[model samples]
Target chain A: MTKTRTMLAAFAVGLLTSTAALAGDVRIMWYSDGVEGEVLKDLMDRFMKDNPDIKVVIDNVSFSVVREQLPVQLEAGDGPDIARLANLKALSKHWLDLRPLVAEPAYWDKNFGDQADWMRPDGSNQISGFMTQVTLTGGFANKTLFDQAGVALPGKDATWDDWAKASKQVAESQQIPFPMALDRSGHRLTAPDLSFGANYIGADGKPAPLDDGAKGFISKFIGWIEDGTMSKDIWVSAAGSTYRAGADDFINGQVAFYYSGSWQVPNFSTKIGSNFDWVATGSPCGPANCTGMPGGAGLVAIKYTKNPKDVAKVMDYLASEPIVKEFSERTLFLPAHKGVIEKGLNFKTDDAQAKAALGIFVTASTGLSDIARKLPGWAWSDTVYGALVTRVSQAAAGEMTLDEAYSRIDADIAAKVKDSAL
Target chain B: MAEISRQTSQRRIGQSLGETAMVPVSLAMGLIDAPLRWVQKTFGLGGMAAFFLLPNMLIFGIFVLLPFFINFAYSMTGGTALFLSDRTFVGVDQYARLFDCANYLNPNTCAEDTFWTAVSNTGWFVILQVTLMIGFSLVTALILNRELMARSFWRAVFFFPVLLSPVVVGLIWKWILQRQGLLNFGLFGFGFEPHVWLNDRNWAFAATVGVSIWAHMGFYTLIILAGLQAIPKDLYEAAEMDGTRAMRVFTRITLPLLMPNLLVVIVLVLIRAVQIFDEVYVLTGGGPGTSTLFVTQYIYETGFAAQLRNPGLAAAASILMGLVLVVLTLVQLGLSRSRDKKGARK
Candidate 1:
């Protein structure tokens, strides 16, 4: 946290003294789920105190509202200096060009090191923005429950099928009501594909471009849930709070294994660290190697910038160890830098298993962009997930078989593709 | 004959000399007045009226009228925030897009669901709300008018919701309906599953309507009570003497007397009902797939949400809705006029 504040202070100073014509006031539009808005305010105050020539104004809107309103405000000529956006769908439509703004690529590479490839969604040499932090959603298991069920962690040799078998054993033990709880939220499904080097089709902006070995892995992950190894009811929330409730149920000893993204790591450690021991691992893979779901929002400078040079400098500094480490340590997020994690931040968990999980994420997936953003049928995925969950629930209730559920989802996907001939 | 002719000529000569100067003076006055009359008629009175109403008119024009008109214009243009540099002015495109949204977003709503939802929701609300509000107040006024119980205490109790803020009402109800909230605690005590009332579609809709009634009924109740008290008691007394009973007297006299107040109440309630925004926005946010999404929320979504940054489309929808409401109001006015004529005939 101290590192984070100091880094913010330094970054603010750089922003203040830089060449800004008319010492123009920068109105930044941002979003707030919690203390992010407050942290931005702190950053602003530090900037304004040093410069005093330029005033920094902040308008924090809801995440969903900001998502919908950013383009609207920009069109109306009322957008802020900076905004936070979820990296969703292809940058094909709302692409930003930071090439002309930032420091030269050689200099950026010297400072940021090898970790900047994750920022380029299109995989082009064009670095649109700098990622503040990175997070990957994989599989997390409870060590205590694993021991109680007499099941062992699937090491490097084991695959997802073995993991499911172990999970089935844990469920048969029944002390844990559910063996695995799968989060069917749009982003996390990519984790299943990533565990075995697969990507959601259309995630990358191209035609019929599925990952190296995706279809088989997708079927198995779907099979695990459909085969009763994982329960959709434990994780899915149509209107109720779905995110924490799964972890809450798991932490409270209702479930054995929880599958979710890296965002809720703090929530898990804070809530359940003292009571039960847990293990985090690269999700067990289906084939060659374990992988992770790769998605992170980047801080892009708008084309209508007053000082592209300065904005580029800030981006460069933000990618630097001094800035990125501070942002990570204070924000309780995974550092985007390579050696920063070696010099630890505030990941206060006593359990060795949780530490192992963090290590797995670091090793499992190269900091690469997932393909779902460019996928043609994100709407289709929603329809599929919605339909699949309903059918799977019916199957769980003895209304259909595993084969029947899979066939239904497969048919829907095919039909959706045909309709979208788009 | 010579003497009479001389007298007549003498009189004519005298009259012509006296009145001849007045004719040219009158002609000049009329000629001078013509341009002054035209200028005053064209600019002065009209300008002053506009000037007097200008502050409000300008405010209405800038905030409400301009936004509505501009939203319609922009909806046609299909311009976005990031692409204003290369925006095209496409006409009637947004109205066509509304059908597209209806087709994709809602199968049933393609024709006029968005507009009609706001209308029917407002309509049903007006009917039940006005009837219940007026009825409760009338009953209370009757009881208070009677030599009976603590009228002031009950009046305050009923009117308390009117005093509390709607935001406060929304927040309090939100707290009460949350998963671990007061409602769930009660449900748990009775061995029932604690439903997520505010989050669910059907329950969320009901809760919004319920909160609306709870917050607004108090004001309407007070107004109806005031109307009820103003009715003359002699007619009721005379009816009672002539063997007409309580219900009979209420229908014949109290109701007839209250028509003017009732008409005012109806119009105000209808107007207010058409523009229900805050509670719904703060409450459910039109979630669970837009089951409770009203026209105002939809317009806000289109204009400001950046979800679909075609303000022109939102503006077109608004104009259409405004026209619908205007026509509906005119019909209400026509009904009231007929009622007045019938009352005068009686």
Candidate 2:
């Protein structure tokens, strides 16, 4: 009888201690583009050493999980304590407001204030999250390929046509498959669209129809695919708005010019590594303006977290000026923190090309169009983007006419809007 | 005399130990025996059968029937919400939207053009895949059933793909088909121009059909081979004795005997062809402009993968696909019943 009593007592104690331990646990769902996962893990280890009572666990996952699965998890009111998300504006309602929970609301406001609206509900002063990096959609040129082909890289004020023509020349001379290849992503496409003076927003603050500016660029894009000036493999390889990057083709020297984004800096720095020379060309000029879309992934606290206080602590530590500066430097990500940006970062990389590319992206960030600036916080941006990618790819594949694709884009966005209506 | 006595003593001890081990089992039976007896007395033997089936029925209801009902409910609602409680009831509006087409023939006229395009693609895929799958599987099975050298090795070679995961099958074929892949290298070596096989619409569609057939034909071949082996060998012997031609003998004896298996294979192949997604999705990603897009992938992307998902629309599309599968299943059941009835008559 005494032995049984002791066993039951031990079990009860174990359960109580485990529950207490779990109460302090903070889980973060993270996805990385480059070596950021490792950088963050190192920082997290240091954080745990300092705050032993508050356990921080990082769940490393693919970008697809963050894009596709995390939204579903959030919708079901079940997810990690925090998540690093790219579609921050669309899922803003599910985020925890750290204004009350954080140690100093003014600190957060002064540091992350500029981009806070991009990850919170409209008309709310909620300090929801902070952008881990500031990304701008742009172009990268394979300098080695151009050099091998005896073709000079286009000038700074070069138009999309000039770049396309020059890249095609280099591709032909080098006997490579793709002259130019843009990532099969809506965000990537929008840089060129905005440069062509495409306005995605209307007077009602809803998605506008595909205007002449958008059509002009898209029609040209489709023609390039048809004429083999652009890589058809990237665009038509998938259907229905599925994202595919042409970085591999570019890295492999098959593509002369690749249009992706600033986020590919570290990825190319790590993967391309002296195999070939590359340089960021920023976005090419259009009839309207030379511009690129402004966007990035943000780390946000989920409202459904049981350990809100612990989550706030972790967020506070990660959002500190010194920590953000260190993270940006080590990961080679462009910092979004105002203080960190003002202080300027010495990006920790030996790759001259990567350093130059980072400098180019920072310069490109200043030339962003007004529409591009607003798009990151716009609720209907993703809706428009999804429609553009789906229909434009179809047109490129000769499945439909460019005019039909434009019509379909409008209809698809309208349907999405209606479907989202309460 | 002492050894025999010792052996008898050992045998007695073993028996005693066996009985002692059964004590717990006997006690367990005794504990439940009374309740079981009472249940049988109150409800009769028919109810006892149902009582025994209760656990499986409960599982089926919770996992299968419950989700199915919830899915049907989702079909009747509209919203971007993942949970049913948060969604608004739209009462078949989602289905109406799917059917809201200016012209049924051209997907361009449909409100949901991608869905219609997928349906058309799936239809073509089913016809080509089912016909070719049966023809190839039947031929392979016949070849394997013959008295050939390394017969077991040949069977294993044919059955290898069936054991592979669909994703592995897709990746293997993709490596061979992509630009700069082995096929292109071989073509270049042979002084022929290398073509991008997966980038062209016609080639992409054909690849999806061909790859799916390759991945799945092995399983069907094994089934047909089993049916082939089950045939009475003496029938072939008698045909030879009568100086019957090979073709005539096969048409008369082999095909007649294989009819039941063939019917089963046809139904199975047809059903599977309609439900195809994973291997094809990985292979073509429903592209070179939605040319390889199928019904299952359409439902998946609409519900889950899209930037702003419409679960209601996806659920409606799924319910429609389910109805098509239901009709296919009924046909299979009818064919199976007729086959059973013919056996009964015989």
TM-scores for all candidates?
0.68, 0.95
Q: Compared with the true structure, what per-residue lDDT tens digits does model 2 show for residues B1-346?
A: 9999999999999999999999999999999999999999999999999999999999999998898889999999998999999999999899999999999899989989899999999999999999999999999999999999999999998888989999998888889999988899999999999998998889988999899888889899998998999999999999999999999988999888998899889999998999999988788899888999999999999999998899999999999998898899898889889888998999
Q: Name the runs in model 2 displaced over 4 angstroms.
A: A1-14, B1-37
Per-prediction DockQ comes to 0.10, 0.81
The window of 10 residues in a row where model 2 chain B has the poorest summed lDDT is: B279-288
TM-score of 1: 0.68
lDDT of model 2 at position A341: 87
* RMSD (CA, Å), each prediction: 14.4, 3.2
Question: In angstroms, how far off is B239's CA in candidate 1?
Answer: 4.7
